[model samples]
Every structure is written in C-alpha cells, then in structure tokens.
Target chain A: MEKAEILGPAGNLSSLKAAVDAGADVVYLGFNDSTNARNFEGLNFTEDDLREGIEYLRGKGKKFYLAINTFPQASNFKDWENSVDKAVTLGADALILANTGVLKYASEKYPTTRLHLSVQASASNYEAINFYKKHFNIKRVILPRVLTTGEIRTISENTDVELEAFILGGLCINIEGRCYLSSYVTGASTNTEGACSPSRFVDFSPTDGGGMTISLNKITLNRLSAGEKSPYPTCCKGRYLTSDGELSYAMEEPESLNALSLIPDLIEAGVSALKIEGRQRTKSYVGTVTGILREAVDSYYVNPASFAVKKEWTEKTRETFEGTSSTLGSYAGK
Target chain B: MRDKMELTLGPILFEWERSEVLDFYKAALTLPVDTVYIGEVVCVKKRSLTIKDIETIGKDLEQAGKKVVLSTLAIVSNEEELELVRELSKLGFSIEANDASALKIAKDAGRTIFAGPHIKTYNKHDAFFLESIGVKNICLPVELPKESIKDIAQNTNLKYEVFAFGKIPLAFSWRCYTERTYGLSKSECAWHCKDHPEGIDLRADTKENGKKAAPIFTINGTSILSGKNLSLLEFTEDLRDTKVDALRISPQYKDTGEVIKIFRDKINGKINYKDSSERLQALIKKPLTNGYYNDKAGMEFLEINDILNV
Candidate 1:
C-alpha cells in the first residue's frame, strides 16, 4: 500500500504551527476574501503570515498548499490571478482551485506549480475529472462527497490525476460549491460569494411558547424545545412546509463527516492524500485531526493488515466536527 | 423594425423521441414567435439526438423567420459536456450561458449572450456586474419576487427576461434522482429519465410531533418544480410595466404552440389581461401558479386582483 499524505486546514498562524507539530505532511491555508472558500472575517492568513508559515513548513521539511479556489467573476479575474502569482512566488507546493479561468491562467503563468482541483468544481466522474486534467493539467482532484467508494475506485482507475478525499469536517447535503439552495433563500451564494448560510441572515428568536426558532433571512429554519440547543439554520437543513403536507428536513440536517475508519479503504482505493476540512476552526481542531489521521496513515503503511481503525480513531476526529454531530458520510459507499 | 415582441421557445429539457423533437420544432415555425433556442439543456448522457439535428432545426427555424440560438447543458458534469459547450460556441450562433463556466467561454468568444437564471444575478449590483461582463440579457431566478425583478430592472442597463410559463426549474445537479429511485447508479442509469418527460413527482413528509404540513414537490436531482406550472400569461400587462424586455415560455411535452399564442395576444394588447389569462388557464392541461412572482412562499398563490393591489 502506498503512503497517503495527511493534510490539515490552517485558519491562522497558530493553527498552521499546531498542524505542523501535530504531524501534518501538508497544510492548506487561504487568504482572506473570495480568493479562498472560507472567506470569513478575522480568519485566514495575511501575506506576512503566509510568508512566515511557508518558511516554517520548509524548515520542518513539510509542504504547503494555497487555496485560491473561489470562482472568478468575469471582471474580477485580477484578484484570483494575483493570488496564484503570489502562491508561486511564495514557493507554495500546489494550488487547490475551482474556477476554470483561474486554472487556465495558473497553467499559463506557473506551469510547474502542482494544481489540485477544489471540491467546489463538483467533478464526480472520470470524464469530468479528465476534462479538468486535459484543460489545466490538474495533478490531483478532491472528489465530491456524492461518490461511493466503488465509484471512487473506478474513477481512479480511469483518470491519470492523483486523488484526494475529504476525511473530516462539514458535510454538504447538496453537491459542495454547486449548491444554490442557500442563495435561493438568503441572497448570499456559496459559489461566487464564498458565503453560504451567511451569519447575517441567521437569527435566533425565542418563541412565545417555550422553544426558540432559528431563522435564516426571516424564514424559520428549525425550532427547538426550551432546553434544547438550536442547530445552525442553513436552508438545506431548514424545516419547511411543502405542498404535499409535511414538516421535515426538506433538504438535510447539519452534520460533519468523520471518515477515519475508511482511511485504509481509501488508501486501498488509490487515494493520494487525506484532506481535513474546516479552515474556520481553532488550532486545537487542526492539531487533533492532523494527529489522528497522521497516525492512521503511518499505521496503514507499517502493516497493511494490522491497520484496523478503531471507533476511537473517528471519535478523536469528532472533537473537531461541526454542529456537534457526526456521520460517516459517503465514504462507506452510502 | 419588427413590430412584435420576440417570443423565444426555451430548448427541450427532457428526453423525447428524436422524431417527436424534430416534428415539434418543425411545427413551431408556423407560430408568431421571433426566436427559438434549440438543443438539449438537461442531462448530457441522453444520446437521443446529435448536434447535426440541432443545426438542421436551427436552419429550419431561421428559414421560418425566427432567429435560432443553441443552448448547452445546464450542468457541465464532465469532459463530454464541456465539449458540447465548446461545439455550441464554435457553431457561431447566439448562446444562452447557463453556468458561470459557459459565460466565461461565451465572453472569450465575444459572443452576445443571454444569461440563464441559474447564474444568480440578484441585485442591481449583480446585474450591473453581469452587464459589464458582456451579458446582453438575464432571466431572473424563478424564485425571485416580481417587485425585486422590477426594482433591479428599473436600475440596471441589461435587458430582463421573465419566466412566463411552464414547469419552473428550481435546482439542478450531477446526481440523477430519477435513476437513484430505481436502485441504479447514474452511470448505468439506462436513460430511465426518458420515461418521464414532464418529471416524476415526489412527496416529502415533514411531520414533526405528529402534525401534518404541506408536502412539497420533489422532482429529479436538478429540479424541484412547483406542483403547478408557472402561468404568467394573464399578467402580461404587469410584466410589461416592469420594463421586462422579453418573456420566456419553457417547452413542455405538449401544446407549446397554444401557450405561446395566448401570451402573444396579451402582450399585443389584442385582449384584456383578465380574458387572456382565463383563456390561457383553460388551455393548460394542468394547474397553474404564480407564487414566486408574488414573492410569497414559493408554493402559495394569490388572486390576480389582489396581485394588482400589491
């Protein structure tokens, strides 16, 4: 069995250091703004922070991947293009990008820098994966969660590019990045705007009756009992009234994916790297997930048959899980 | 100058027999519409017709005094679909850019384009941004209220198009719910979607604590259309006053020409809005709805007189 790279998300300088110390073979970070997917306030790296972080990782003999993955608006190609140039100039190992325009530009300007396709592009099958490869010379693709393990194996067999799979963090009910359900209800789009279920659109109000109602853009998403905790009110997870007479999760519930148990299976299926999501998380999260995945990857290498993952491996990953809920996600082929 | 407003028949979205599609477009030439956007805009795996068939239809529509534009698939899942978009662009005809990637290619080719509603142009800022990117026209998302559309239209420089009739396309994706229903993988879907041309209707049970609520229509992986088709034939006056440049009527499995004629009479002022609306409703084989236009919950409907007061 070949070794699989353990990747971690770095929201800031502290998280970057923690991820490195915790055994991250490669750490991924992004600049603040739409150039990266997690375009939140007070998170992500500054230019100096990126520079310092890269030097630290290089000294430790580790790799750094820059996420310049957001889609580029027709007139806004400059911001996306400049980030790619900066990533190349800063000696970053690779770029994880979603936009075709950005990919085309980077292939022309930085032909040597490895290009990994972001999950935002939603390329599920071999044909879609190969399309990106032929056009932009993408080296690796982060497979969308929609695929089953069998499908992933088949795709890897057909495509020339390496494969990366998400092992932990937020699980999107709709196809990641391709989802418009949030934007349809809240006016903030995840695709171009880098914000889905934007915080401003969410409001939690106590009902006159004992519970609290979590609303997104004035539409009630879900309600909780007096003592119950209200989940984040994203449109996909919202409780709604439909035409056929029902009140339920019209889309899905808020849950994080914990795929530690499937690490060996993914490696067996020819996965090149393991990605841990949630760049908006704390250093504790980055450290914890990176540590566990690192051990699992190393164990799989030492003795392939001895690499049985205990429930505790994924349980350790659960501490960094979002929304206080976890699922095996699509990795088990469901 | 043309005296009549351009009526564009949206491309076929379902898998119909190739002969049926050819016959439909051939019959569409006699209608008073101005333009016809031909070709498939749904699943890429449907290999019923080739690009040559679309070109022949475009020629026939053009010879019938109607301009023709080819539409690419809405979801560009893989390389084959990307090649379809590239081929459509190389055809040297007007194209409707559905996805952002399509818009990028259309802009690269410097082709004048109609931006599909799926592109998400919400406010005046977005409209202006798209206009700057060379989108000559835009179809507001079906879920947007008429007031927002009117407000944005009043401020933006780009032409606005409204969904006048047909089953609204609420969403699209790489997963084929229709195939998944039969316990089959999307790759080996067997083109099962060819069986349901309108869409296979589904019901969701949203009961919590033993209370019954309205069940919403859940269709394919891509679309969650309203139980009722969007009928705006009766509101042509209101739509026109919003300064909308055109009204887009999506093609269904049947009676497309009659739907186009009813809207034509209303837009031409040949009949009153009420009379035109009643006749249009009577012509439809199914229930009609204008919920999204009224800006209420997507499934709710309002009286025409009440809509006027609002």
Candidate 2:
C-alpha cells in the first residue's frame, strides 16, 4: 500500500506550528503579495516571515511548498517572476502555478524548480494534464473537486506526473479557476487575487420575512430565515427561483468537501498527496485536520484491513472549522 | 472611421437542435449581421450537433455572404475538451477562443482567432498582448463599463465587439447549476437547459437559506447566468462614436432576428435611440438590463446622486 503525503495550510505562524504539530508531512503557504492566490490582508507571510517559517518547519523535519499560483497579467508578470525568483532564492521545495505563460517562463529560466499545477488550472483529465507536463515540465497536478474517483483513476493512469487531490476543504461552486462569476459580480479578480466571491461586494440585508437576504452587489442572492444559517455571501451558492418557478440551490450550498471515507479508495487511485482546502483558516483547523489525516494515512498504509472510517475521524473533523457541516462530495466517480 | 458598423452574430451558446441550428444560420444569412460564429460552445455533453453540423452551418453562412467563425467552450475541464478545442482550431474557418487554453492552442496552431468576451481582457496591456498573439477582434467582457470599452477600443488596433442585444452570459462554471438545481449530477443532467430557452433568472431572494443566501442566477449545472437580458440599444450611439467595429448579438430563445433588425435600424440612424431601446426591450422575453455597460454594479439600475459635480 502506497502512503500519500498529507499537505496542510499555514496562513500564519501559529497555523504553521499547528500544522507541523498535527502531523503534516508537508505544509504549503503563500507570501503576502499579489504573487500568491490568497492575497488577503493579515494573511500570508513576508520574506523574513517565510525565512523564519522555513527554519521552523526545517526544525520539525517537514517540507514547505511555497504557492505562487496567480496568473500574471501583462504588467504584473514581472512582479510574479520576481516572486518566483524570491521563492527559489529562499530554497522553497516546490512552486504551485496555474498560468501557462508563467509555467513556460519558469521551466525555461529555472529548470530545477519543482512545479505543481494549482487547482485553478482546472486540468481535470489526462490530455490536459499531459499538455501541462509536456510544455512546462509540471511534476504534479492538483485534480479539481469536480472529478470522481473513477475519473481520478483514469487520469492517473494516463499521466506520469504525481496526482494530488483535495480530501478536505471549502467547495468552490465554480469550476476551479474557470469561474468568471466572481469577477463579473465584483470587479475583484478571484483567479489572480485569490479571493472567491470577494467579501467587498457581498452584503446581508434583513428581509421583510425575518430571514436575511444575502446580496452580491445589490442582487439578492438568497433570503434565509433569521434562524436559518446565512451562508458566506458568495454569488453562486445562494438559492434561486428559476424561470420554471422552481426555488432551489441553483449552484451549490455553502458546504465543505470532506472525503475522509474515500481515503482507501483515493490511495487505490494512485493519489500522491492529500490536500486540505482552507488556506485562510486558523491554526486550530490546520493542526487538527492535519493530525487526524496524518494518522489516517499512516493507519491505512500500515494495515489496510484494520483501517476503517473511524467514528473519531468524523467527530474530530466536525470539530475542526468547516465552511458548512461536513459533506462527502460527488466522488462516488463517473 | 466607418459610418456603417458591422454586426457579428456570436455563436449560439446553448444546445440547439442540428436542424434548428442549420435553420438559424440560414435565417442569419438574411439578417443584418455581417459575421456569424456557429458551433457547440457550451456543454460537451450536448452533442446534438457535431463537426459536420458546424461545417454545414459555416458553408451556408459563408455562401450567404457572412464571415463564419467557430467558437470554443468557455470552460475546458478535461482532455476531451482540449482535444475538441484543438480540433476546432484546425478547422479552416475562423475561431473564437473563449478560454485561455483555447487561446493558447489557437495561438500555437498559428490561427488568427477572435478573442471571445469571456476572455476577461481588461486593460490596454491585455488587449495588446492578445493582438500580439494574432487576435484580430476582441469582444469586451460583459461586466466592463462603457468608458473602459471606449478606452480599450481606442487604444487597441484589434477590432472591438460589444454585446448589442440578448441575455449576456454573465458567468460559466464547471458545476452545472442546472443539474444542481434539479438534484442531478453534471454527467446525468438531462438537457434541462432546453426547458429555459432564455436561461434561468434568479429573482430577489426573499427567503434566505443559510450560507446559501445569495442572489442565484442558476442556468445549467452550477452556471449562474445574468438575471436581465442585456439591452445596449440605448448605448448604440455611444458605441458608434467609440470606434467599435462590431456589435455582437447572442442568439436567444425568441425574436433574435427581430432584435437584430432593431439594432440595425438604430445603427443605421433610421430610428431614435430611446424608441429603438424601447422596441428591443419589449421584444425580449425577459426584463431588459444595461447593468454591465453602466458603471453601476451588475444587478442594480444606475442611480445618479444629486451631490455629484454639475
């Protein structure tokens, strides 16, 4: 039985320690710049902070992957290039990228840098995966959440690159990086800026019916009763009344993707790494999930028969911070 | 600047029948549009029409004195889609690259392509970059303001295409909103999009479903479409003055030719802007909105505050 590495997020220093303590073999993080996708305030690390973070992780004998995932616009390409150069200068283990042009430039300019395809690239199948591998020397590809375990198996068989799949995290209602819904509703860019259904454009108004009305730039997203949970005000996940007079969640409800049950199957499908979703999460979230998954991965590899969807796994995961109540997403695969 | 603007009929984005699609092009031949993009750009599963369908439509449109372009899907998720895009690029007809992967493949194939509106080409730099990659015409993203369009049009050498009439595609996604709405997965979605020919409109959500409380414009499979059918008839004169080479009219559920004729009359200076707008708005099956072109947010009507400088 092959043991896949458990990757965790470290939004800040405390989160980094938590992830390490919780048993993450490798931790991924972003720098506080436009280069990384999660370009949020008070999130990500500075150069000195990254250096310190690297040292801290090194002391724990863990690996660190620096994410520089945003596709650079024509003017911003230089900024991204500089960040990649800095990441390399800092002895980062790997670079996660989505932009074809950037991948090409990096592969040609710095051949030694390990490149992992970001989920934003939406390379779901073998041919798309092969294209990235052939052109930019991508060593691994992050499978989008939309794929099934069957799709994952087919994709893994077709590609030589290591496959990483999301086992836990927030569900992106849009197709990975292919969504323009966020940018269209709000001027902010989700692909490059790393903010989805950006917070700036969303607002909550008290509906006449006592529930809250979630609004994205003044378009009423949904009207939830005051007692009903008001989801994160994303443009897509809200309920809609279609032209057919049907009222339903037209896109997806605010839910977290929890695939702990699929652990043995994911290993069977030849996934090299199991990644957790939230990067803007707290230290507690990073530590708890990382520790739990780390143990699960170990137990499964050590004795497949003894490994089960333990009740404790479910309870511990539920205790961790999630966008919604945990869910086993659509990977019973096509 | 040319006094007469060219009208480009953008590709039929939905899954229309092969016969209906053929009939659509034959009708488009007699319409006021100078160019037509014909292909299956939306769902890969909706294969009611094939390459043969595209070839027949292209030949008929070309014979009818219209330039024909083949369009690619906006969100290419897998190998099948990439292969489809590559095949589309190889077609002798002009191509409209909607997503980045298509643009890359088209560029690599050395084909002169039309950069579709969904490309999100925001500034002069992005425009210039597209032009460098052999993009002859660039459709402005729907969310762009009039001023931004004007600036981009004036600065870029490539021809600019704006949405003139019909439901502007606000967004495209991997998860089919239609399937999700119907409680079916994307693979099992039963072509329910045909049910709402004008696309679905998410009304004001008065009932908030926790975390799910947001204005939803569910179309097919996680795809949230725009609430209002985009009406730029009032802005035709402004568009004309901005050196816009073409105005794109997307084919909707009904009265598409009539909408084109109304735009033609406005563009030819045969009708007043307000009357043309009113006529077009009345003809549309859905409510008219100029949200994207206006500087205001996508949903609300633009309001002028009295406190602004006179």
Candidate 3:
C-alpha cells in the first residue's frame, strides 16, 4: 500500500514556500478572484505569484493543485474557463473544480488534464463520486466533512476514485457549496462571491459591560462577555435565541476539527490524501501545521499499531486554531 | 408574453407525523396547484412517510389531475440515503433530483427529472449541462437575482421554476439542530422536530438598547431557513415578463392552502398585486421579504414600488 500524502493550504508565495519547506507532499492554492472559495481580499495569488509558487514547489519535488471551485455566473462563464485554461498552461498537477459546467469545459478542452472534485461540490455518496469519475474522469475527490470513518470506508469500498479527507482546520457546519446564510444577511453570495460573512459587513462594538458584540450586516450574531474571545461572525457559529426563549449556539459552536488521533482510522478507510484547511491563514500556520501533521503521518507509516498522537503536536496545532477547542467532527460518528 | 404559468407545491421540508402527512396531501388534492412534489428533502432520518406512502399519495394526486414529482434528499452522505434515492428512482413517478447523487441515479434509470433548487444551477452553462443529461425542468437556486434568472431562461430551453413563496431554505448540516437543542444525540433524536412542524424560530436582539428580539432564522432539524416568508406575489407581473414557466410554494405548517389560493388568484389576474400581497401578509404570522428577487440582502423587505422603479 502507498503512504498517504499530506496536502497543505497556501495563500501566497511565502505560504507556499513555507508549506513545501515543512514537508507537505502537495500544496493547493487559488487565483485572486471570486473563482475560488476563499476569495478574501489581499489573499490568494496573482499570475506572477502563481509562477513563483509553482516554481518553488517543483524545485522541492512537491506537487501543487489549483482550486477553481466557485460556481460561474451566467454573465461571465468565460472567467472560469479562462482560469481553467491558465491553470493547465501553468502546469497545475490537477484542477480542483466544483461546478459541472467548469468541469465539462476543463475535461473537453484539456482531456489529459487531471481533475479532482472539490469538497464544495458536496459529492458525499459513492453514486455522486462515481458520476463525476464517469463523466469528467476525476482522479480524486476531497470528501465533505460530514461523513464518519465507517461511512468513508463504505464509500471507498464502493468507488474506484481516490479519497482526500480533511484532517485539520476550520469546520463548516453546513455542507459546502450549499450554504446561503451569508448571502441572506449580507447580499454577498458565498456561491458566486466566494465569501461568507464578508469583512465589509462585519462590525464589532464595545458594550457598557466592557465586552464586545459582533454583528454581520448590522445583525448581531453574538454578544461576548468581558475577556471572552469572539469567533468570526459566520452565520452558522452565531448564538441566537430559539423559540423557547433560550439563547445558545443553535447550529454549531466555534470549534476547529482536529483529526490527529484518527489518522490510522482514516488511512484504514482508504483515504489517499490528508488535507489541512485554511488558505486564508498566515505562513506560520501553514508551516507549523504541516510540520506536525507530517511527523504524525510518517510515524503512522513506520509502525501502524504503535502509532499514537503526541501531546506536543495536539498543543501546537491547537494554538494555531481559530477557536480554543477542537472536535473530531462527524468522523466520530455523530 | 407568457399568459399561463404552473403552480408547484414543493416537498414538505419539516418533519410531520405520518397521519398529518397523509392528511396534507389529501387536502392538496383539492388545492389549485398544478404539480405536487412529495418526499423527504431535508434529512434522511425523517421516516414519517415511507416510499410506499409516497407512491400511494402520488397515485391519488395523479388521479386528481395533478402532476406528481418525487423529491430526493438534499444531502446524500451515506449508503442508506443513496439506497433510498435509488429506490425512489425505481418508482414510476418523475423524480426531483435535489442532490447530484439522486440526479445520477434517476437519470441512469431513464426517469424524467426536475432539477431541484439544491442542484446549484447558477449559470446558463449549468442549466445546459443538466439539460444535456436529460433534465426537463430546473428550480433555480434561492439566492439568484432577477437578472440572472432572465439570462438563464433566455439561454436554455428547459422549463424554469422560481421559489415564489414560503420561508427560503438557507443551509443544511449533518448535525441535527433540533436534536442538539434538546440535548440529544442525532442517533437518539426521538423525532423531536415533529414538535415544531413550522420549525423553531431563531431570533437575536440586534438592537443595542432595545429589548425587542429580531427573528433571524428557522431551525428545522438539520436545515436552517430564513426567518421571514418570501412572498413574490407583488412581482407576479415581473416574473411573467421574465418568462418563468412555474412558481413554487414550499409547504408551511399552516395556512398553506389559503396562501396557494391567493397566489392562484394573483396569477389569474382576479386579484391585483397589492391586494394579494396584503392578504398574504395578514395570513401569515412571520414577516415577508423579497430582497433576493431585487438583488439585495435576502433578509430585507423591499417594497413592490421600489423594486419596479429600479
């Protein structure tokens, strides 16, 4: 059996180099536009930046994947097509796409180009996975963070495509590519604009009790007491009052997904690659996470039965996370 | 301009008792709707109405001179859900493919498919792609603006349906919020969502100094919906001009029959836009919004005159 690959996120040339230097087998990034899911301003790469980043990865004998995952607008489908053409021209190892139209264009125009389905596609079951494989010849699929390890094993047994599972990073409570809450409150479509809880609509005001309240589009998402850290005002992680007059985190709390202890189970479930989320994070995050996960994967390969998570690794990864806590997410079977 | 448009009743998104489910469809047989979508589209754990029950309902609706389409789950994460979709495809009724997995299963079985809103048909290319795969009709995504809908309708020959009324579905998650709120695990949820057939209203105190609570969203099991009902009755003229073939009304817990009657009257020009809009507002307790149709924040309530002037 082949060793699983450690895929890391890189927003710029510096992060790309950091990930590569820290022993990431593959680094994924996106162009600086709404064509990608993490379409935040001042993040992502320009054409010049892509050239440098790709060069850096090739020098280190590592691979890089280009993410063109957002659904293209009817008025400007050419923008997505142009990105596909550019990615192939720039020698991307694979194209991570979410929309069927974009997948059709990439497959027909560049038949030999390797295609991988992005998690944003939300293709969770084997039938959906096989559909993409049959149509576009997708080589791998980044599984959505909704399935348990047992379910992953069942899907792997049923489909012939390689599976890439998220092992670390911010967790999306809602299924990817299907959420419209951000657009509901802010008028910025996460599907088209590629941003959720966009920064322009976010406001933080100090209260009389010395605490702060975070609002998205002037709609309060949460009220933090004094010394309590506030998570990003994404609609899902917000605390709201239910019909029963109780205020609580109705969707999900602010917690990152850490699957360090489940690495062996994931490997046994036939996951070929382990992906770490957060391309919008800093370079140090990319470096530290990649290094720790790299050691974990290596240790598992060395001695499968005796492999165990180190306390230092969990502590280091937790320090770089968005929230103070971490969860096994759906991988633990509800 | 198109003079006639069909009225479609979307599948029940909330959990209801089996008897209540049958009673609703039995009453739907007498409504003015032209087509009725029946199935569990939100969570697979919902087993109030079995496939056998849906088949029985589909037959009765068909005999009553209404087209019936079986809707699939919006999220297919496991083999159990996939098997359910596969079984649904085998039934003789036309299947409404909510997820790509259902789309594949139904298309492969040679079933006529209506691409549901969750399929993400944002561009003409997406519509064309689904059309090429034998999809005959498409329900546009909830967040698309009027202009984009016009562009797609102009480019594709497929029948287009817009979500014209009811609470807009916002997001779906694996963790059941209904179970989470009750401090129960998903496996042992005990069907608590049945307690709130209309969904649990999620509100927040947006005002800094006021004690008023503003409704934010509606938690329905694993899915979240916009707190306000989306009523496009005032824009019937505009939608007619956009060349939409159908308008969909998602089933609410109560007053759905009255809501359907008002929309039918407006479509037939018996009641004017303002009168129909006023009646709908008075009928439902929740507020109404049309911001998504006007290309603004979906939670905003845009006036009809303001939309027309723009």
Each prediction's TM-score versus the true structure: 0.70, 0.84, 0.98
Q: Each candidate's DockQ score against the native complex?
A: 0.14, 0.32, 0.83
Clashes of 1: 18
* Candidate number with the higher DockQ (1 or 3): 3
Residues B177-289, candidate 3: write the lDDT tens digits: 88999998677778999988989989875654566566779999989999989988888778878878999999998999999999999989899887887888889865788
- Cα displacement (angstroms), candidate 3, residue B55, comes to 0.9
Q: Write the per-residue lDDT of candidate 1 for residues B214-255, one digit (tens) a residue.
A: 333445434445445778776776777777878888888878
lDDT of 2 by residue, A185-212 (tens): 6656566567766667778778677777
Q: Could you give the candidate ranking by lDDT, starting with the highest? A: 3, 2, 1
Model 3 deviation from native, Cα RMSD in Å: 1.3
After superposition, the stretches of candidate 2 with alpha carbons farther than 4 Å from their true spots are A71-82, A100-111, A204-213, A223-227, A243-246, A304-307, A321-323, B1-5, B17-19, B77-91, B99-164, B207-218, B232-245, B265-278, B285-296, B300-310
Write out the backbone clash pairs for model 3.
none
Question: Against the true structure, whose lDDT is highest?
Answer: 3
Error of 1 at A188 (Å): 1.4
Restricting to chain A, the TM-score for each candidate equals 0.93, 0.94, 0.98
Give candidate 1 misplaced runs (Cα > 4 Å).
A208-210, A227-231, A322-325, A331-334, B1-7, B11-170, B173-248, B251-259, B262-310
CAPRI class of candidate 1:
incorrect
Q: Give the distance in Å from residue B59's predicted Cα in candidate 3 to where it truly belongs.
A: 0.6
